[model samples]
Target: DARVTQTPRHKVTEMGQEVTMRCQPILGHNTVFWYRQTMMQGLELLAYFRNRAPLDDSGMPKDRFSAEMPDATLATLKIQPSEPRDSAVYFCASGTRGNTEAFFGQGTRLTVV
Candidate 1:
């Protein structure tokens, strides 16, 4: 079975740095989601796309977070001007909304100093 894969499972950076995390969603899937997990925010939805079209990103911080689907199987999330408050486990998930179970990447644990 195909699965979503992520790179740089762990990342550490100082404040005001740029961080990019990559994800390869399952083949033939068209929906992708970015989520941040923390004790305070819990599991919060950052952004998502369906069939390469952006759906909603109201849960994300507009100034520092960006999510995109550049191709069928590739999705990426980037953060600029990162701060210590950005430390969290960033997860990439993909699925057919309302149809199948979402597949999650191993996750990129980002820590900003």
Candidate 2:
């Protein structure tokens, strides 16, 4: 009964708008990841947090993207001044240490015009 869930599965936005995406990770999972999938990126790891603390976010665009875990089951990624180049599928995944199987949400497909 536990699974990752994402909101606003599809979004259409104009350039320079603020976009918010939400994720609910599976229960009891300690690691959460944010990824962007596109023709150019091919499922790039954008950011991740372990035990509610961010481990790495080097793949995320610092100026426009931010990711955070406000609680055990919730994670969020926000983009400000979203550009056409940012249009892609954003996914959230969760897993435990040394666990290769990650549970992924359906993803939020953003189309920036």
Candidate 3:
């Protein structure tokens, strides 16, 4: 059994700084998703990729945020000039089509001053 893996599980940054989070989705999972969790918004899907191709990213703020699957084993999410509002736990999940369960990473907790 394999599981999604995330790096830098906890992060603290100053406002206007840059932040990057990384994840490794489960092998054989074609669909990968990024999510942001907050008290107000709960869990919001930011972006997703299928077979290493980005399907949609409208949920993310294009001005400062970007998500990409650089290769089959690596996915990255970055935020430049990060703001306090951007502070939240970002999660990575992966699942294949026809699979009802989503495998999720431990989640990267980001804090911006």
Candidate 4:
């Protein structure tokens, strides 16, 4: 079945550690987004891409967070020197251009102690 798959469904790490999350978007979906959810911010869009090209990442902390789509099927988000404040559920979503609906992955729950 076509689906968005996210790895490392749950993670716990010390502050200052590096965290890497992976996502495999559904085949043929040309748009992708990286989002973080927390009680304070609700759902926030951290990054977005279309046709494998990065379109926006303004919501992400440029100093420590990054999002990239290295190929058509893979999208990655990395946080270096992760802090406790970064704890949240990260999600990857994909959709076709012009489609109003987006398919979301299960999400990776991260906790930095």
Residue-level lDDT of model 4, residues 1-113, one tens digit each, is: 88999998999999999999999999999999999999999999999999999999999999999888999999999999899999999999999999959899999999999
Candidate 3: tens digits of C-alpha lDDT, residues 1-49:
6999998999999999999999999988998999999999999999989
Show where candidate 3 strays beyond 4 Å.
Answer: none
Assess every candidate by TM-score. Answer: 0.94, 0.96, 0.96, 0.98
* lDDT top scorer: 4
Clashes of each: 0, 0, 0, 0
lDDT of 1 by residue, 1-113 (tens): 78889978999999999999999988888889888999897988899899988889998889998888888878889999899999999999989867667889999999999
Instruction: Report RMSD for candidate 4.
Output: 0.6
What lDDT score goes with residue 100 in model 2? 69
Off by over 4 Å in 4: none
Q: Scored by CA lDDT, what does every candidate get? A: 0.90, 0.93, 0.94, 0.96
- Candidate 1 local Cα displacement, residue 31, angstroms: 0.5
Backbone clashes in model 2, listed as residue pairs? none
Evaluated at residue 41, the lDDT of candidate 4 is 95
Clashing pairs in 3: none
Error of 1 at 49 (Å): 0.4
